[model samples]
Target: MASPLITLRENTIWENKHGTVSITPRSLCDVWNTWVGPGVSNGPIWRPGLAGLRALVAQAEAQNQRIRGLGGAWSLSPAAATHGIMVNTKPLNYIELGFRDASLDTAFSGNPDALCFAQCGASVLELYQYLEVRGYTLPTSGASNGQTIAGAVSTGTHGSAHSIGSMQDYILGLHMVIDGGRHCWIERASKPVVSPSFCQAIGAELLRDDALFNAAVVSFGSFGLMHAVLFEAEPLFLLEKSLVRMDYARVQAALGTLDVEALDLSGGRELPFHFEVVVNPYRVSRGQRGAYVRYMYKRPYRPTQASAGGSTWVQGDDVMTMLGTVTGWTPHLVPVLLEPILSAQLAPVQGVAGTPGFQFGAADLRGYVMSSEIGVALADAPNAIDAVIDVANRFHWSGFPAIRYVKGSDATLAFTNFSPTACTIELPSAGSPRTLEAFHRVWDELRARGIRFTMHWGQMMRENREWIEYGHGARVEEWLAARQSLLGATGQRAFGSDWLTACGLG
Candidate 1:
């Protein structure tokens, strides 16, 4: 049966807001419109929504064409772009919270109320609003709440939560459409969430394997089309945010060692829910206010609590606004243009409190901005920052570096795979050829300095198989082995893309 939810247009040019990735596909397919609630529906509205996605996969296979799923189009890399068929999944926004007693496995031990089943297209902001009203919330999300749930998790999106892991860490299950349009409900064998009855009712085969689950959770869309995800949500809480400016020398000690006392926040030795440091590369000398520090402490939820309003520094989705205005790379002009903006935006704000949704809210796409994130061991962060600063200054790059720490993830392909904790340094700069050249140089310089690092899959970086292997080591082979075991030869080729091939993952 032909699903009415699927629409295909020929010869469409798909371009992202950042202009970093542009693709003119043979066909652009929009996969969904109306949200089909649970239960088998014989109606024209497409009772079983997976039928459309499955049909798209079969079409791609039969025609011998590559197909890729497009989410919020938030990725700076060409990860989602394909020359054959591009499916826009933004309309697949559907949220189902809580599970039925019969639908859950008897072995399931976690709270069912904390479980959320969200379609691939559902944005992070939507989930935030949906859960907040029901007295629930996600444990963590990226700095900005713009990317779709599937895209964010698959790419290993993270924020400054050293205690908590990346967004993918909370995921318990994945509903995916694999090779030849075969749909399956995948979860960890050791930690089963849904029962076989649930899978049967949803018209999916049940497969509980930890290796497959971990690989698919952060596989960057190579596994197949992610129809939906089941993630563990937490009780609603507030974040008390404080932003302050300090000299580079003052915070150097705390960079490698995450001693909360050294940060000098109101909480003293108590660790923060979120911690990040933004540095102006041009002004890293002693006594200079080059570091802008932000810390958010967890607070009990209160209905009477005043909103903190939306004012955050460079962290997640949005680019550096100051660098976006610069047309060319001019070292002299960069400091002159940056200092005033930094001074105004980096001023201290204390005792402001809000929910995760309010603190990290909507962000507009900046086309002129480009970002490259590198993850290294927590203890190696100070040295990494120094390396980046040197490269930025020498290259005359018109941007700054922001440091964030996250607990290492168990996901096989996660960039934040460093043991204990991973410190991620994000460089957001003007989108220029010279800036890209500088990024390539940074990768080389880091390698030369023997600083082992991994690049974010969704962000801008020089793609090299050797670099990927250097960063991930044996995890790459483990991920590939999992893919081979799950998808087999046919599905691997169907889901493979140029980007995946470039990184040696395909």
Candidate 2:
């Protein structure tokens, strides 16, 4: 059999909006591979398949070179960058459906009908399209569908479903290529999935351990190269959405408890499938108050004419990108100029129904945006919001703060580890120096007040090791220990980046 095609580029300059990385060499490969094909080398060779991927890891080990996986490059932080070799995984998009007794372990009780095996490079949109064709859909996804599955899960990307947690929460297993060319398939010991044959077919050694699994789920590429992931998707469903403008008090009440009755939503008193609140800090006065709220309720999936909804869904990128442009032109007049934009953009309160993919369409800000998101306990939401609002008012921040809630995530390193639920305070704006400075000040104040909070790994944040320890506490220690035990010193060096070292995770 022939080895999979692989390409190497030298002295490449890879850059995103927030950071730039100069790679000495970069490797790109496809996802097709035949393990027993012709010209099999004594040592591993660089290819897209499991064997080829392991070969790259072996080469990195042999050369004492660091390796990092590059996906959609959607992160606002430099967590994915490295001075050493970069492996481009975008070409390795592949998706597979699992069946009952697919794992070598017969005791596996996972619902094979819900299982989806997605290669690391598959974009969120690709997965959604694939599942939609099979009469299934992801339970939750971020506001956008452009991120790679591995990148989103690794960074703990989340949606605003108050009942559902972040992306990592749905993942059941991981296929990782660790140091020394070891390929391991990991799943939680408490809830095992896949049979031994499944592991063998993928050329992986099965290991069932909860701690190790949780650590790797949101390891941010420190654990190893996440070649693929096995997640439990759900039957296709539609979401009925409504956008309304409410006062600060009403919005605060809903954020604190997610009580549908208190907010008086049009969809009766039941809890919503998804909820989010956007607040304009400058218009907080009673008469001028403005809070744009979105509520989505789940509906049973039904095959309908494609023209029923008439493509009413709109991508968030157009609005956000326009906001970026407007803020860039007149940063000083943001408070005076932003009120009408918010009112005009969020005035519609009618019901519109669509699939999860259509509801949360591709949100690409086109590299003109900067954001900072912090997660706090649901009960502490009001205080956190007030604190942030106070700072924004004082500094005249250009960006408005939005609040979205999600059930706590099970990933060990997830920022939304708060019990019950977490309220995410997200501030997005054009990449302005003043906005960035104000965001830092908010972080400082939150820390000084001892307000329990955790920062999103994929967003702009203060890279302070002490703050990480303070926020995550013992969980950070456990995550670090898991990394050390699994990756050891060699794997650490190979996957470590300056950002990881700064966070004390390297």
Q: Evaluated with TM-score, which candidate comes out highest?
A: 1
lDDT of 1 by residue, 1-506 (tens): 23336778999778875778888898999887444345544543323456778888899999888888888888888888888888888888888788878989999998987889998988988898898888888899998887899999988999998999899988999999999999999999999999999888878899999988999899888999998999878999998888888888888889898886876788998878898898888888987888888889999999734432344444322335446545345533654676665766667788778888888776756446788899999988988889888987887776678899999989998999898999999988777777788888888888888999999999996677888989999989999999998886778888888888888878
lDDT of each: 0.83, 0.77
Top model by lDDT, which number? 1
In candidate 2, list every pair of residues with a backbone clash. Answer: 1-37, 1-38, 103-194, 103-195, 103-196, 104-195, 104-196, 104-197, 105-195, 105-196
Instruction: Determine the C-alpha RMSD for candidate 1 after optimal superposition of all C-alphas.
Output: 2.9
Query: Model 2 over residues 1-506: C-alpha lDDT tens digits?
Result: 55555567666677754442333344433344434558665532223466656777888878888887877887777777776767777767778866666453666555677788888888988888788778888989987687899999998999898788999998988999999979999999988887777777657899888999988899888888888899888888988888888678666776788887877787778888888888888877676657888888999987743211133335332244446556546767766777887776666766777788777676534435678889999998888888888897888866777788999987898988888999898887666778788988898878777798999888887778788877788999899888887887898899887788888778
Number of clashing residue pairs in every model? 0, 10
Once superposed on the true structure, which residue ranges of model 2 sit more than 4 Å away at CA? 17-47, 100-104, 304-322, 327-332
Alpha carbon lDDT of residue 505, candidate 2? 75
